[model samples]
Target: MPQFELANWLPQVAWLILTFGVMYLVVRAALPKVEAVKLSRAKVISDDLGHADTAKTNAQSVEAAFQAALVAARTTATKVTGDTKTTAAADAAARLKEIDAALAAKADAAQATLAKSQAKSLKSLEAVATDVTGDMVERLTGRRPAADAAASAVAQASA
Candidate 1:
């Protein structure tokens, strides 16, 4: 009942106005500090974004340089490997040619030696065959065959 009484209304209105006025002045006084903090924060964020972009660009350039170097190194290595293989192949062919020539010379020498030995053995075998035929004829007829005839007979049989 007292809250709603007409006679107390003016005092309550006065106190309410006084309280709200003080709160309004305090909020008004802090508005510049809040605006300053917001501006500083925005500047810091903008600076960070610019730095990040610069770093990204630098990283991309460095990565491109590294890739170029890698490609150049691979090309150099491939060329060197090809040159080495060619040299090795040439050396191998030269060595094989030398070995083949040496083997051919040795085979020719061995064939000459074999031919000489075969000719000497054939001469000795002919002499032995002539003697055997003469002895066999003398044993069967009690008369020795002539040396020239025995040799001629052996030669004819062999021919």
Candidate 2:
């Protein structure tokens, strides 16, 4: 009997009123709270995502700074190496120049000594020649060469 009565239009009207009243009360009471919870969760997730993005940007900035420092260090090292090489080359050149100067001075001194020895040897040879010519003239005709003729003969022999 109750099932047959529920299927009738009068029972249908009663069910409609009950369902509408309950649904309106539930929506009025709970819908705002649910919406508020959803909006709060969305804001929290957005904030967390923003923090992650900021962290990523900060890491990239740190990497860029590290790379710049490395480049600076490499440039400084290269400059130092170039400077050292240039300094070494200059020092070597200076040492070579000093050595050349020393060698030139020694060569000049040796040349001067040789020239002095040659002059002394020439004087001795001239004296011996004069003595031999005087001895030959005395043996041949009993006369000696004059001083001027002896001087001229020594000059011609040197030439």
Query: lDDT per residue, candidate 2, 1-159, as tens digits?
Result: 775665587877899999999999999999999999999999999999999999999999999999999999999999999999999999999999999999999999999998898888888878777777667767887888876677677778778
State the lDDT of candidate 1 residue by residue for 97-127, as single tens digits. Answer: 9999999899989888888988787778788
What TM-score, computed on C-alpha atoms, does each candidate reach? Answer: 0.64, 0.60
What TM-score would you give candidate 1 relative to the actual structure?
A: 0.64
Worst 10 residues of 2 by lDDT: 2-11
Where does candidate 1 stray beyond 4 Å? Answer: 1-35, 135-159
Tell me, by TM-score, which candidate is best. Answer: 1
Please report, in order, the local distance difference test score of every candidate based on alpha carbons.
0.93, 0.89
Candidate 2 lDDT at 40 equals: 99
Off by over 4 Å in 2: 1-7, 107-159
- Model 2: how far is 60 from its true place, Å? 1.0
